[model samples]
Target: MKTNVAQLIELPKFLDKRGNLSFIEEFKHLPFKIERAYWVYDVPGGEVRGGHAYKDNQEFIVALSGSFDVLLDDGIEKKVFSLNRSYYGLYIPKGIWREISNFSTNSLALILASTSYNQEDYIYDYNYFRNYMHEKD
Candidate 1:
């Protein structure tokens, strides 16, 4: 079984005397096209988000402000990534379970997706997701 692992992508940062700049162009900095964009904020303390995995959609997540930790699991292995910069993003592939946690105060999370919203694409059960990934092997 091959479990795809997420990787960190450093976006272009153009420093200027006025302010800093960063950009992520679809198919240029990401492995997929940008079909959707969203942001997560106002998360209550001690609360977590993203307890599911997508079947066909790929996502790129960035910490636009503050910091947070992303846990990725692929049935056989698990890794944690700390996102604390606006110029860097985590590229999450399909079939991998992801969870977001430990968000700092007033943190902003920007997510770029490859596909539009689809309820059927979500895998909400951990056991079901594990089996589904292995079945592909």
Candidate 2:
């Protein structure tokens, strides 16, 4: 299996006196076509979300309302991405672990996935992910 690195992608932002607008079109602004769309909100303070890795799903996460931090681990290395802008998003490929935390009040996180929900495609154990990555190489 091939490994993909996480990256920050900038979206097109249009400035106007009325309000600022940003958008992401399927396969135009993202690496993969969107098969599913989801949003996370109403997170209490000091709470965290996401604690798993996808087997073949890639995602692009955007902070549409407030700020949050994304912790990504690719078995051997880990990185943190701070998302506080609507025009910037973090793109995470498959075979990586992710966690979201430190959300501000009324924060809205929009996620676009390349695949639909599949129970068997999730790896929630860090040790299992490490072993799986090792075995793949």
Candidate 3:
């Protein structure tokens, strides 16, 4: 898998006098089918999350409220993405190590996954992830 396959996705947004609305469709806004959906919220100050890669699961991460940064490492390069909009998201392909940090207060992170929860699909150790990338090459 190419490390640069990760991309930023912009969803359809509609502005109204009352409020703004945005929606995401599986296989339309995202490149894959939606099988699982979850959110991370109420994270305390200076707290961080996600330090692993998925062997097969791809993810689309969106900030529903507040802001946060996603650090993506492809074993050769690293990039930081700041998400602060509900209509925008980060598409994380499989085999890329990712970390979420620098969260603003009361930030809500919504993650849409392409697959269900599977323990065997996760690569938690950085060294193991590097080896896995080497093997893929």
Candidate 4:
């Protein structure tokens, strides 16, 4: 299993006196084309959102408001990203275990996915993930 993780996308910020606008358009600014969009909200502080890995979906996560931390584990190393800016996004590739937590009040986590929702694509079990990842090779 390959556990290579890196930042792949960044939203462009257009600074203006009127208002600061940041945009992320699929296939134009994002690497993988977007097929779905979702946002996490109404989450109590210290609650976790995700604890799964995708088989073939790529996602770009942005903190539209407030702040939160994303814990990424590629089976080898772990990385944490504190997302607090709406103008910036963290690009997460496939096959990485992710956990989103520590949300501040009124925080919004916007995610742009490369694929539409598919229950079969989610590996929710940690041991299943390890086995499936090993079999992929």
lDDT preference between candidates 3 and 4, better one: 3
Off by over 4 Å in 4: 1-4
What is the lDDT for 39 in model 3?
98
Estimate, for each residue in 1-137, the C-alpha lDDT of model 2 and write its tens digit: 11277999899999999999999987777878899999999999999999999989999999999999999998888999999999998999999899999999999999999999999999999899999988988
Q: Write the per-residue lDDT of candidate 4 for residues 42-132, one digit (tens) a residue.
A: 9976789999999999888999999999999877678999999998788888998999999999999999999999999999998888787
TM-score of each: 0.95, 0.96, 0.96, 0.91
Number of the top lDDT candidate? 3
Which sections of candidate 3 miss by over 4 Å? 1-4
Residues 1-137 of candidate 1: C-alpha lDDT, one tens digit per residue: 11255899899999999999999998888888899999999888889999999999999999999999999998889999999999999999998899999999999999999999999999999999999999998
Which whole-number lDDT from 0 to 100 does residue 75 have in model 2?
Answer: 85
lDDT of candidate 3 at residue 52, scale 0 to 100: 96
Higher-scoring candidate on lDDT, 1 or 3: 3
TM-score of 3: 0.96
Q: Which scores higher on TM-score, 1 or 4?
A: 1
RMSD of each: 2.4, 2.1, 1.9, 2.7
